[model samples]
Target: MKKLKMWLPFVTLLFMLAGTLTLQAQRKQGVTLEGYVYEMDEDQKFPVPYASVSIASLSIAVTTDENGHYVINNLPARNLQVTARFLGLEEQTQEVDLSKQQVLDFVLLVSNFRLEEIVVTAESNKAGAATASKINKTAMEHMQLTSLADVMSLLPGAATVKSDLTSVTTASIRGGSSLGTAILMDGAPISNNANMQIMSSAIGGSTPSTSGTTPSIGVDLRTITTDNIESIEVIRGVPSVEYGDITAGAIIVNSKTGRQPLTIKFNTNPNLYQGTATHGVNLGKNAGSLNYSGDYSYSVSDPREGYDYYRRVTARIGYSNTIGKWYTNTSVSFLSALDKAEPNPDDEQDVTIKRQNDLGIRANTKGTFTFNRNFFKSLEYNVQFAYTDRDSYFYDEATNATVAYSLSKQDGAVLSSIQGNKIYDVNGNLVTNVPAGEESFIAWTLPSQYQYDYTVDGRELNTFAKVKANFAGDLGATHHRMVIGADFKSDGNVGEGKIFDPLNPPYRSVSYSDATQRERSYKDIPFVNQFGLYAEENFDWEFANRHLQISAGIRYDHVLNFGGGLSPRVNASIDILPEALTLNAAF
Candidate 1:
């Protein structure tokens, strides 16, 4: 009985080895998969290049070539789920046995419904994904949005506020400052860093109420029209390293594209009237498409107060084309805004008239190049340039009873009376007045009820450029998509700032207690330059009947005067019940 027991143990080990060998032989019997992906048009088939073909179970994916031909090697000879997808088209999935049929072709159809037509409300991402919300054109139309600011109410935890264009409006996310949120239009930044519209505060020249411009805070949402927007995506969670110069969150705006019929809309409210026209034209065969849009709006604080009004006009032209393996889109836009507030006819004493004008032009080009290679997937680039000219004027009647003002750009107290009065220094020494347009360290008290006007002219320019490369491949059982990119930006202003008569400078207390305002030219300030480098990796792994997705990235930024800063981020999610439940975490 002892000898039989030893033989039985050896025999069991031999059987186990044979079973393992048989499993290895079955795995080696893989088949090659080759197919063509195309679209049908009136019973005719045309190749759909750059379409994605993937096997989710095995984490294998590939893109079709220019001829819509795709090939996958060493695929398991068993039943598998294959998916094919492309932009602006319906996705198709099928289950088939590779051993029986190696060549699997797909015919994709154009989606009949627009994304906005189906989504009537704000749509959120799945639980396991990043915290994001998307608002489409249909939602904006339904809400009768007059400006981009009105769209903010659609977000969670936000209350609807009546749309008003008479005042400057900015966006704030997560209770953070407006500067912390980054606003992007078509992947290009809408920067307000070089806005120097405020008058020299030393002379009691604060921001004018009718300026309608936000300086040092962020973009003024009221200036951005919503008629030409296609979609808006707000990211409240930790965003990808591709976005920088932000701490709270990001708002991405995508403009309309492709071929569409002409659309004209007119809207009227109690305080606002807006009109917009948009059209898209297809240039036939391989020529691509051209799009044009224009919007005009006028608003007043009250129907009876015609003296205070706001006017805005915007126009845009865009071109989209695909040449060879590269696809490019270029656009140019123009904007003009005017805000004016005049004195009422009944008020004889108050002659204050405030007017602000803003003119801007922006141009941008973005392109993508696809490559059918083992390691490299695609390359993307974007370049943008923007220029804005702002003019602010404030006119008021000053009635000083016994106030002494200074015209001296230097420090120390110098006092003078009306035009005929003598000037004196703080030490009670006699000071001679210089001729007009000459240097004089003296102060003068102006006549009562005189005209006090000052103008601030500021010209700002901004430029941005970025280049990124994407790579996709399989390493062992994991599929990875890696992205590496670098971006640079520059902002500067060159304009005559705070223009005023030296003889009758804005009234300010001549006492030592009050801070003095000095004349400063916008061109004197230095330009700001920023550079950033980023890298990110997104991977998917399937194990033990569960799927895991993780994204990890890091970024480095260097400012012209400031030192470099580094930021690291990670986000992970795991499916617990296939499509039913998932756990997500981010840092």
Candidate 2:
């Protein structure tokens, strides 16, 4: 019995050791902790490529790949503390309970400045990108930019000028016209591509010529106001093939989004006043979250104490959310403006220019999907629609009433030799003219003879859509990213004008009505369609702990109307003294 008792104790210990060993072996059966690292970008989130994720307890750390994905194998199933960090971003720490193979995602926020011993994200500080600039909310607030035009003027080789106090503002880059520069709001174009000018002449006379001057010429920067804006990105030099119909450059604007503290803002100057409200909150995991922003602004060119001559009102609202792997955003905006024609002192004035009304509306929607696939990392799509309407009226003061002037010979043929206010006598033959009645016709004056009342109306519709895919992989010793996209656009314009000239004295009569005296109108609608396909490849080689980097990229764009354009870019950077000095070159 004593021997059995001793044997029992030894047998119990052997059994216990065997059980512990078996349990550990089962737990270590190739378990792994894997997930992706992302950064919160206003309304949506994007992967932070090359982020650092570590576990101090296990003395193990790994850097994310191009798609922000990482995996740690053979980790024991238990609670652990994990930390993720990136340069110019706040660090994040989470308690992850690794039971079996677990998936956990980290969302980090952007920091105000770069941190020491931090790894930089691929898209944020592309070491070899030569012509990319970022303007954060802090910089925008410091500059107090009122419009996108103001933002572009601060860039290299870009300029925006206002000719007069009431004149509209225009933008240009590197001596390129505004038409060549693509202005983008949420990755879609917002430029006007139709005529909005109105011109008319007497019932039968030639149309009045204003020397080709038109209202709302080019992309009117004055119509764009900065409200609830988060950041702006300017691409000046060679850009990716994903962008089309752009020869000069591109400006991309991003708005505030996601859950945030509710706040109200108000600002004003001598001629401008603005107010805004913003809010953000979480709404569970399945239902996603919401972020919203709304703002109103009023501006004037002539705010003479208590009186205002020209004024404009603008309002906008934006919303964003994320559900599962899909993220969506939407926005709506409105604009209204009024202008009074400047009076001429030399011309005898009885009637004055009436108030003109210009109104516009715009809406946009965008969505993105993140997936783990063999060929693509993510898919993105965007759609936009916009409309504009305008109206104006012009009349003569001297006639005291709208009138139409007409001239005819005794044989009933119309005459066309009237020069200035001087009229010539018409003979029986259409080509025969005499000065016998010149004094009487000249005395009648051109204003009274060719007076008329007219009105002009114009409208436009614009729409755009695009789909793109992003892919990343390794080729040889270099990292590679490929982008492919297709885009389509449509623009249409409609305009109408009506003119009525009434009866005047001996030189002009409406009842007998010569060929030139009558009522007339004009109506027309023009449209344009555009389509494009593009592809680009970006590659980089790193050596010696990132002490030297060489990046090269090439883009191919095929546009329906513009044929094809090829853009090649190369950039190199070398860190000489760690964080102190770096040499960069681009071509």
RMSD of each: 10.8, 17.2
**How high is the CA lDDT of each candidate model?**
0.75, 0.57
For residue 423, give model 1's deviation from the true position in Å.
8.0
Question: Over all chains combined, what TM-score does candidate 1 have?
Answer: 0.78
| Residue 478, candidate 1: alpha-carbon lDDT | 62
Best by lDDT: 1
- Could you tell me which residue pairs clash in candidate 2? 351-397, 403-501, 403-502, 404-501, 404-502
Per-model TM against the reference: 0.78, 0.63
